[model samples]
Target: MRALRTGPLLAATVATIGVFLSLTGCSVAGDDRPVVMVSTNILGDVVGELVGDEAEVVTLMKPNADPHSFEISAQEGARLRSADLVVSNGLRLEEGLQQHLDAASAENVPSFVAGDAIEVLDYSEGDAAGNPDSHFWTDPARMIAVVDALEPVLAGLDGADSTVISERTADYRAQLETLDDEMSTAFAAIPDERRALVTNHHVFGYLADRFDFAVVGAVIPGGTTLAAPSASDLSDLVDAVDSSGVRTIFAESSSPDRLVQALASEADISVDVVQLYTESLSDADGGAPDYLTMMRVNAERIATGLST
Candidate 1:
């Protein structure tokens, strides 16, 4: 497991080496509506939908980037501090960017943390057990909670149109409700015995909890992708995979599947590897371009992978 950085060290790192945003840009101080800087693409999509044209939503993470380790450019870091509002997944999901977020808070930029809006799931087992799982978007109900939490936050933003925000929030919430039902229906088709998951990392705890699947184990031992599995870790997971009898091991679009593939080779039984949009949204050309589409596409892929 990776050594957990102390909060002070993280803050010092942020002060010294901030999340590097690659894009060049001056701060948007002249916009009529508040400029909201969101840390990840997933939150960017959902918040963009709710706020619509009410605010300029500048998302820091690029499409399909790993949220756990992606950094912002110094210019982007400046924008993060200067923005009217900053939004982050929180609960330390933004592993590399926590310092910059802390700096933003220190600078007094009003911010919203999506993690605070819903029930948090901790790793049920492994070295990182009892640590909050930051991938709560897997469960649409939690996202609904995020939407509920974000509405008032958006309403409070400078120059926010409360009525438009309210109307759009309602529309998006309905869409999420529809998505939750769809995911539940899709997962219901998989047998109870087949509902076990092995993945790149411990990213699907909320999804497993939401839909009644068991997280057999992860390729990495912890909640963050930065942690690599040891030989013993891989050996233990291979044993679990063999006993669990799951046909497929899921990999995230953002993370490398090489570890998962290596694990498959070591398993006593043959197990296929399937890719899912576990952590980040993909580009527009990819399958999961937005939050709703992401969940729907992931559900279909998971159901097919488990049922077959």
Candidate 2:
């Protein structure tokens, strides 16, 4: 009886030790994956899709957060510096996180700027006129360019499978091409007179440039959400809105729509305010969870809002 009890105790002890070692091994394995830190959620989604299971992507910005003003914690800053690669939207977009990015770069962390991949457009009519616009993801074609530039860089990372990255890149590029075609078709259906756009800020320069829509005006005076519109600026935009006969003004999901609504009210003509996912993506359950979905939703919303 004593020998039988002792044998079962020994088996139980060995099983407990094995389970603990297995758990510890899993943690180490996860940590072994290369860390790719991204500045914004939108690019984070893109990088995550490209890397798949080959790397661990840590996005600094949260869902539906403003890229212009979002800040990171100390731990996040540490991670950024320690990452094998860092990705950001350049052209002075991430005003809040610029310091941390610079710190990481100083530490010799490899970096990729999405803005460097595309033909940058200037803010034509705002306080930021002549400044390069950082909202290139507004146009699907531009995003395709970003994916093209990013593929080779991601493949070059140690521990990343170049073949897998290339395959995923091809698939994502196809989806972006399809999205561009669909947006073109939808925007084409709207009459030329009604294709004017007004927004809370200068967030849609790329989209307007791509789809042949005229930017009537913006409630805010600059390209960033951090800028506040003066009363004179609002008055000027209202006049522009009245003259352009812009029936719908699009507001960004990442920004407050109050200013947009106020602008619509101040306009001489009746205007409808529609919200778009312009800057950042939403949570998984939100309508614009991924980059592709976010663009699709915005395109449909713009088409419908302008059409009506």
Task: Compare the candidates by TM-score and give the number of the best one.
Answer: 2
Cα lDDT of candidate 2 equals 0.92
lDDT of each: 0.90, 0.92
Question: What TM-score should be assigned to candidate 1?
Answer: 0.89
Q: Report lDDT (Cα) of residue 245, candidate 2.
A: 81
The candidate that achieves the highest lDDT relative to the unseen native structure: 2
* Candidate 1, lDDT over the whole model: 0.90
* Model 1 segments more than 4 A misplaced: 1-30
| TM-score for all models, in order of appearance | 0.89, 0.93
Tens digits of lDDT, candidate 2, 6-41: 999999999999999999998887677788999999
Deviation (Å) of 171 in candidate 2: 0.7
